[model samples]
Target: MEGALERSLRVFSGRGVLRTEYWDATIERFHLVSVPPDTAYQIGYTGTEPLWIGAWSSVGGDEITDESTLEPAARPEGNAEFDRIMATRSDRDLATSPGYDGEYDADPDEDRPEPVVTSFANTAAKLCPKAPEVGCNADRLAWIAELPELEWFSDSTVMKLDPGMYASTHTHFENEGPHEEIYWVMAGKARLITEYRDARLRRFDCAFFPTGNPHGIGNVGTETLWIGAWGARGGIEGDFDIANLDVADRPGQIEEYERVMAARKQRGLPLPPNADILDP
Candidate 1:
């Protein structure tokens, strides 16, 4: 599994042309310099740009592999000293500050809820019932996994499609800019169709679609298909190619119409408005 996971990571990371312009610009902009050996270095990030650090070491002109030569490194003790200083400052500030009125019962730090646990089975599934008008071919299902709000992620979902079912090729955007997507095949086989290339997806296999790349999936095996997907910044605004998709079983045109209308209403559009469309 570890080997396969590494291979998948490589496959996704190397999908597109690598760019070093931003990296070069950042190095110049920050006046960055390499740290000298045996020297302590630190950086306080302001979240203005992406930053990553890597370390490497070699012993006797080769990589270290002998466990017998390993020794326990000293852990940083600055945290304890910093905490002590902060505690002393806090105490001095409180002594000279105004007394609290006790209007709030709970401490601000303690007000956060405990970690939430949920499963794919327990999460509500987004249904895609067959609708000819919408160019849907079959009934499909998707579930948004319950997770704490993330800083960079907008979606964490599991989608299912039955044999012979396919979804329309689509691209997702947020705030008028293309957002990235990643999908891992959890069960069954799939044919990932994208504008740039198509690939077969097996259980445990993963793929990533970078900005402006349109993609979709088709269940090409005998069993049901399940895919775990994650998207950056949510990617809710979509541009779909409905003609290429193949949908299957499920009915009720009225229900489909109602669902469409409700979606439009949620977007704060007029009740009897033209179909929502995206510019190419």
Candidate 2:
């Protein structure tokens, strides 16, 4: 992932479109949109695609409209206090456990118990410095920073897969309600393998995962993969994991999953049910 300084530099360099946009509730800091020259100006390459790239501020909900006009904003003065709070919640302590396996050596009809605490809104708020009122983990992922209050919010625990650790077979439960998500790669490389398409994902690459689709991620390289995931809530309860069931064993279920994957591929979106690895 690019450092804070590098990201700031890139924003001012005009390498891409840089603007702040309003999202659900908060104002995103740096939103980059890609622009290209006319077809006649082509030197050698001949491709017409708008490449969108950029980052945003996770704090203060401030938007950077004009990069050229942006002055160096002073850092929060209370360094000691901020350091103390950050030290208490390093990356290791908040790491997520591996996802549940889909193999059913046991009974398939077994019912799992509902968690006493289904929502993390309160917990996340306490941990986050921006919106202390909401309990979502501000430090849940590697790339996101803290943010202040917002009318709407969504969050989830994510794990980046290390290449050469596992195969590409997995399953994610479909939510009963409407929801949408984006999978943004922070570091390394990955390949999203679904019933329909197999696409490569790299640093700064992003893929969208729509509701009701079941898919998984595979590390396509030897390095550790880091990803940032943002999505809306559907209030569903089901585990996302790798399943051993083959298409021959469950043709109907596999067919439905494939349809979703194919649709997303047509629109150049990521596969649903993004990668979830279990820790041994």
Candidate 3:
């Protein structure tokens, strides 16, 4: 009987038949196979069929050879050379304080004449409508990123507004966005009149406004007024049509608006009618 059973098993095994069981932990499936090497076979359960096959390597293991791989520890000198080249090509070298180049510095000084002026009109000419008088203008040494040679961020223009012995009124509108505007009274005193208040901003003093806020500046002091304005959002359009506001015709209205603003300030409430005073 034993000899007969051994012969029977040998006959079945010789016909490319051997039984082995495998548990796939990932899929939670058990597989039983009787197949030759490199041969595919299908197994089914509950009307679902899945193929099973034998591979030379285990599944989900690294297929790449170690000999063909790049080892960071083995290429110290090559990495150093690459680092040196990257540092040479970087803009870090230009990121420093103002340096002297005959007349201008990389950075600007309040006491000195502006090193550079970037015009917004010139920049806007490439984009949309133009505003020559009250567009973007700044007198500062800047690093224009677009034109690396020019040394500012954008193609915006800069203007030098001077209150020479008398106060002058100018309308301004921004197209790009709100800017961190500052009125650095370099030589004389000035008053900045926005949609809100008529505050006295003196020389060397600075004031800031959120983007899209419409405002204007006038030299209220008896001297040459120099102010510096620069911001990433300075290229925005003005929210209100400043040209339409007839300051001469609305003097009485402005006085009443000012009185209301004073009361709002005293009560610590939100800015009242002054907030939307320029909507019309």
Tens digit of lDDT per residue, candidate 2, span 158-263? 3445653322232333522244446666667777555566677787777766665555555667687665555433333223311222222333444554565567
Q: Note each model's CA RMSD in angstroms.
A: 20.4, 22.1, 33.2
lDDT comparing candidate 3 with the true structure: 0.30
- Model 1, span 1-280: residue lDDT tens: 0010000011111112111101111121112122212212222333444343221121212343444233312224333323333333343342211233323332222222121223334567677665544334577776665223333344456677887776544454333223566887867888776533446788768887876555667787878887777655332433432112222221232344345445546766333211122110
Clashes of each: 4, 12, 33
lDDT of 2: 0.35
lDDT of 3 at 238: 36
TM-score of each: 0.43, 0.34, 0.29
- Cα deviation of 8, candidate 1, in Å: 17
Lowest lDDT 10-residue stretch of candidate 2 = 36-45
Over the stretch 53-134, how does candidate 3's per-residue lDDT look in tens digits?
1111111122443422445335434343333323332323321112222232223212211112122222321111222123
* Cα lDDT, all candidates: 0.43, 0.35, 0.30
Supply candidate 2's per-residue lDDT for 157.
28
Q: Please tell me which predicted candidate would have the highest lDDT against the true structure.
A: 1
RMSD of 1: 20.4
